[model samples]
Target: MSRPEPLQPVYQFSSAQEPVSLRQGTVEVDFNNDRFCGMADLVLRFLPGPRLVFHAIVRSTSEPELPFFLNVPDNLSVSFNGQKMEGFRGRWKANGNTLEFDWIPRSQPVVLSDMQPKNSVAAIFHLFNFPEFRGGNYQEVAPLGCALLVLESEDWKISLQELPEDATREAWDQIKNEGGCFLTHMVKMERKDGEQFSGEDAQEQCFLLDNFLSFINGGRCWPVCGVGLDASGETTWETFASPRPVRPPYSWFNPYKASQAELLFPLFAKRWQQSAEWRDCLHSAIYWYVQANTSGGSPSIDAAIILAQAALERLAHHYLVVDQKVVSGKGRASDRLRMLFSACGIPNEIMDATPDIRRANGTFKKDTRWMDAPHAITDIRNSLVHPVSKKKLHDCHVDAWKLSLWYLELSVLALCGYDGTYVSRLTAKYVTDSANVPWGKKA
Candidate 1:
C-alpha cells in the first residue's frame, strides 16, 4: 500500500541551535575569525553590563604575555579587571591587521578580567540561559557566541511611574544621537590543529543573532518583560534570555511555504507613501486587526467592528479610489466594495468563502444573497459605529467576522499578488475550520 502524504502547515516557527555553556549562562554566538593556521582555544564570558571576559588558550613557544590590540571604535576603553588601558599603547601592538594582547593577569594562570565599554558606550552580548549550564566548560565546545543588550545607562530600567515623558524622550534620543550603540563585538580563537573544518554550524546562529538584534535595536524590546515564572507568582529583575531558534526545524509535515505579502505591499507603500489620506487610514485599519485579535467586550466589539470597517475602507480605497483616481461620490460602503471587488477581486481558489463579490456584480444586488451580504455588513458596521437598538443583524456571528477579516486578507492578498497554496491554506484554516459550515469539512 502507498503511504499517505503529510498535511501542510501555513507557517512554521523558527528553532535555534542548542546552547553551549558560557560560564554559568549559555550563549549563541560565532567566534571563528580569519583563521590563520594554529590552535587558538578561547572561552568567553559576559559579566552583566559592559564587562566581557575572554579566556584564550593557545599552545606556548612565544613571549610570556602579548598585548591584544583591537581596532575598536574610539569611545571604548579596555581594562584588565579594574585598571584601564589606553587604546593605542606600546605593549599592546595596535599596528598592522592584528590586535595582540595578553588577557592573563600578572601572577595568576586563571585570567579573570574584563573588556569594558567607555562612558558614552553601552554593550550587550548574546548569552542564552535556559536549563543551567553544566557538564564541562565552554572550552570543549566547537561554537562561540555571546550577549547583546540595549544601550543607555539603565534607561531601559526607568520607573515609568516617575519619569516625565519629555525626560524619557530625551534619554532615548541621546542614546542614539551620541553614537553610544556601537559598543559590541566578539573575539574568536580556533585551535589550528584541533580538527580543521569549515565553520558551517555557526553560520545560522550568527544570522539569527543579527536578525533579532536588528529588530531590538529598532526599538522593539518590550520594557519590563516577564522573564520567569514562579509558582508563587513572584518576579525577578534579571532580563534572562532563553534558548530561541531563528526558524523551526524543517519536517516533512511542512511541504513548502512563502509569504504572499512580498508581492503587493511594496506597491501599496510606494504609491501611498506621501498621501496622508491613504497612509494614516491604512495604519488605523491594520491596528484594528490587532484590537479585534486581542480585545473583546460589548463596547469594545463595537469599537473593533468600527475600526475594522475603517481599515477595510482604507485598504479598499488603495485600489478603488486611489488606483482609479476618483472620488467617493456616493461614499457608500457598498459603493466602495463594488469598486474594490471590481478593482481587485478575491483569490480564485478561496472565492467560494466570499460570495459578496457576486452582489457587487449580480443584478439581485441588494437582495439576501451571499453577494448581498455587503449591505447587511455595512448596516451592522453603521449600527456599531452609530448604534441603533432596533436594527437586528442576522449575519453577525463568529464566522461572519472571520469572513470579513478573511475578505480583507483576500483583498490585501490580491493587492499583494498572491494566488497559491497559501490562499487555499488560509481558506482551510479560517473559513473551513468551523464545523457544519458551508465551506467546512462537514459540508
Candidate 2:
C-alpha cells in the first residue's frame, strides 16, 4: 500500500544538505562528524509499532569507547534537516572497522525546538487495530483531567478521526489477513488551558491516556507515532514508539458500535486526579490481564491462570479495603472475591456465567454440590498452587480462567462507576454486539 501522507512534513532527515524522503519503512539519516567517528550513513527503519531501528557500519580508532553514545554534543542538542530533535540513546557493537549501532529512545520524549511559548498543545497519535466509529468518520470522545467542559476544569480533550481511507485500506487489509500492525485509528488531543504547554507535558498526558485506552480497548493501544503541536498548531515534538506486538482480541467497548466512552473516561480522569492507589491498582491489573491473554511460549495455560487469579485477588483487596473501606485486608481469597463482586454488583452464581464455563463448573462437585463462581475459581487456583487440593480437569482449568477474566472485567467497570453499554464475552453474538453493564442503572 502507498504510505499515507503524515500529518505534516514532520520527519525531516537530510544528507548533503538535501532532503531525504522516507519510503518503504527505511531512510538514511546522516550522522554528524564527531571526535571518535566521522559522518556516516545510518539506515533507519520504522516498524509497525512506530518502533525506530538504526544500523550503521563505521570505522573507530584504537581508543576504546562505550558500546554506544549519542553523536550530538552533551547528547541533547541535535538537528536533522534544520528540524530540532531531542536526545535519544544509541547502542552499538565494535567489530574492527565494522561498528553496528541500534538506536532506541530512553524515556526521552522527542521535543522539537520552539521559538516562543505556546498557550495550548495539540497531539496526534496513530493507533493499531482500533475500531472505527459507525455511521461517521469522526467522533468527539472525552476530555482529560475532568468530566464536564462547562466547569472549565478539563485540561485537554480527545477525539477520534478517520485517516485517508482509500490510501490506508490496502495496508489495513494486509494486517487483517496476515499478522501485522497498521495505522488503524487516528487519535487527536487538544489542550484546553491557556498556559504554555511543553512536549514533556504532552508525553505525560499521553501516558495517562494510553493506560485508559488499553483498558477500554482490551488490548495495547500504544501509539505507532505521535506528533505534538504548539498553540499556533505548529509541530513541536514527534516520536516513534515501540508498542506491544499483539493483535487485539474482542474488546469490551467497541467504539464503532456502542461504548461507555463518555461515561467511563471521565470517571478514570477523576480518579487519576484524586487518587494514587487507584492508579497503581489499575496499572497492575491491566498488566496481569494482558500477560494472561498473551499467546506463545511453553505450556503457559497454567501460568496464565495464575496471573488471572493474582489480579483478581489484588483487585479484590483494593476494592474491599482500600477504596470502599468495607472490610479489613485479611480474609480468605474466596471470601474477598465474593465481597468484591458484591460491592461491584456482580452476581455470585455461575448461572449468569458463559455457557461453556457454567457447564464445566457443573462437572466439578464439592461437598456433594457444585461450587459457585468464587469458590470454584479460587478452588481451581488452589489446586494449581497447592499439593493438598484435588486436581481439577484440564477443561475446568481453562473455563475457570475465562470465568475469572469475566469477573475481573466487570469489577473494573463497576469501580469506574460506568453504567453504559459494553460488549460481553458471555452474551455477545458477534464481535460488535454489546449490552448494558449489569450493575448500571440503564441495565
Model 1 vs. true fold: TM: 0.35
- Model 2: per-residue lDDT, tens digit, 1-443? 33323342234421111222221222223343332333333232334334443333444444445544334332533333344434453666555444455444444333334423443367776665554445222223222211111111167666554444332454456556775555554666766654566666666667777777777666667654567676677667665554454566555776555335655776777766666788888888877776665443332767777888898898988878887798898778999999888888888887655565566656656553445678877877877888475544466666677677778778878877777777876667786777877887674
Model 2 lDDT on a 0 to 1 scale:
0.59
| Model 2 misplaced stretches (Cα beyond 4 Å) | 1-35, 39-50, 56-100, 104-120, 135-153, 193-195, 294-299, 352-370
- Summing lDDT over every window of 10 consecutive residues in candidate 2, give the lowest-scoring window: 144-153
Segments in model 1 whose C-alpha atoms lie over 4 Å from true places = 1-256, 259-282, 294-302, 347-371, 389-391, 419-426, 430-443
Write down the TM-score of every candidate: 0.35, 0.75
For candidate 2, the clash count comes to: 0
Highest TM-score model number: 2
For model 1, state the Cα shift of residue 253 in Å. 16
RMSD of 2: 7.7
